[model samples]
Target: MTVEYWRAKIWGLLHDPVLKALHNNSGRGKNSFYKQLEVMKPWVETGKTPDQSGGKVLENILLADYIASASDRSAIGSVTASINYAPGKNREKGLEITHLLSGARQEWKINSHDELIKGKRKDYLVQKEQKELLAKVPKELQDPSIKDDIKKIKQLYWWLWRCLPQATCDLFKDNSLMLMPAETRIPDASIWSHVSMTSALAGALAGYDLTAAQIQRWQGNDELSHPYLAVFSFSPVQELIKSSRKMRDFWAGSWLLHYLSAKVCWQLANQY
Candidate 1:
């Protein structure tokens, strides 16, 4: 945002997730993710034009762009990213990004996801729910012939679900099967709430036309650790409290998985 921050943007090392994954700390010097960030300056500033790269990095760019953009702060809240341009135990190089993002000296709080979902191995995504959907017989689907459509849906579902904690799999495995009904087997609000929050996050980043009712509906979630479900469907789970956490969180899990699957893929594919 400022001249000093721009210096970091130009001279700072790259800290994006994909670059982190690609350029590990195998002791690669200037040949680091930071170098790649420097090389991609034009793309980072002006953004990818008609002729450019594609695939997941581009997807991440779109996500990162929206997240880092000036307009998304209120919706996503004060954000923190694990990625830092500078390397060291506590050098606080990445904090610069937050400050730059916040436009305040020491005003922003950007902590490292040193142990978040980014560089971590993904497991919750490959649960039985997703496997069932993938392994389903041609007859199981309404139209198996819709090959590309089905693949895209399944992939998006996997990414969104994996983004959540592992407990998510245990919560909504049945609902993801698609053979189940909406009420009995479908995911309840408990599970769905997290997904909605995730959806709200991605939607906010993607600049989707979210409605006030939708935002308000997700605000009543003080039931659990946080009220994030306020933007999601966890209210239903709390409304139907049960002794068994297992049964209670099922619908929420399913709803989150399904809804995020639809929303994430739709957002990326339909981005302007």
Candidate 2:
């Protein structure tokens, strides 16, 4: 087989898992967004004005983006909650799986958070998630079938661990990789987290039937204050590491905490 063919295959193996997890978790309204973008494509490509229906589509897109972009940290006080709310008299509730390989746990020294963060802690052993999410790669890349293309295979390892994570962090503004700052000015939370939270917030705001003036007033002035947003935080790092004997133990505890917290966030996001 050609060297390029093998390179492409390896790339697919690494890329597909992340895409699957993201789609499974955050795919609601994705089709609608794609359709709306398609409708605006012609007008976007040509500098032509849209018709009435097209104009309305553009308006909704702009409104959603504006509401999505606003942040509570700024004086604007964010309208993300308003976007999540839709007019619905009856409420529906159910359980759903939001991600692939979510049920699988990492095979390592520690199993639970208590073991990781408390008691005689062990070194952080690097591990991957379920084989389903992160498929095993060949241990040796120097196979005779691809001896001529060994360089590319070696490069794939660097790309998988370094380049791919950096790209995702840059694109989605997710700093989970912690390779570099996702945002320069306000390097706080992940954009995906913000997107999910705002979606939930919008759903809450939809029921109020607030007037444009009221929303504008809330955005413009800080006087009309009601708890429109809630901030939840996790702390106690020192306590979590009280029993750590080595650097690896602290690292293991932190990773376990982050992994568990992410699972909780995924469930909460799916609930809304």
Candidate 3:
């Protein structure tokens, strides 16, 4: 499929069944639901125009699934229920299950050690493990990408780290027995990081080996101590890494081949 195909598919997935279900279920925060719809309405009414809302529309669209999943009973009840249920069959899966958007951006790079610490939610990380983990991130990841979009990708990684604690807490909270909130909405930090990281991870999975290399080092402990590593140890990552050669092949043949390969090639081809 072309990038346009995946883009439209993702949009339709969010705007149709997801949003439609939200409209009927006030239990899932009618305000948040409508807010998402409002952000998406321009595109829904028009077509695949530019992200004129400066990512706000995409943000709202993605959050809609999380909002829907927060409901115990609602218009989009069964659909959300199924989508939300997949993660944590084993805790080792970490927070990767929370990735809501498919075909997300996937440029993963850890730059400044200090910035990386901040992104990991310094307040939540074990001081010593944090230092070691940061130290171990391969020096290679810091090499500037030959591509033009490294700035944007770096910003995404930064935001993902920024959003880690809150989003991690929200997605994995033990709310199984608690009553569903009248409106289930995460803070803006979670929303921003969620979309940003999804893209970053997507980039990493598509052969940005540095991301996987970093993930391996971060997941060094069985405790899943590192915040981002713990939450991001989901199935897609495992599948993405398994049979690395084959995965790379599939990646090249897939639509991301068109989307990500061109970008990667641009960077590598220009590296001199």
Q: Candidates' TM-scores?
A: 0.21, 0.27, 0.19
Residue-wise C-alpha lDDT for candidate 2, range 1-272, written one tens digit per residue: 23322222232222122322221112222211111122223332443221122332222222333354455223233433321111123112111222212433221111232332333221211112222112232334323343335465545444444454445444344444331211212323333333333333333332223332332223433232122454565677678888788999989998988988888888875673
The better candidate by TM-score, 1 or 3, is 1
Which candidate ranks first by TM-score, i.e. highest? Answer: 2
TM-score winner between candidates 1 and 2: 2
Against the correct fold, how does model 3 do in TM-score? 0.19
Steric collisions counted per model: 13, 8, 10
Index of the highest-lDDT prediction: 2
lDDT (C-alpha, whole model) for all candidates:
0.30, 0.33, 0.29
lDDT of 3 by residue, 191-262 (tens): 323333333332322222222222223243322111123221223544654545776666654544355657
- Model 3 lDDT, full chain set: 0.29
- Scanning candidate 2 in windows of ten residues, the lowest lDDT window is 82-91
Instruction: Estimate, for each residue in 1-272, the C-alpha lDDT of model 1 and write its tens digit.
Output: 12212212222112222122112233211221222222234343543311233423233223433333223223422443323223345433322222213344321122322322244222222332234323332332224332234343343333334542232323443222221111111112122332233334443332323222222232343221111222333345544544337864767766666777678667864773
Off by over 4 Å in 2: 1-200, 207-235
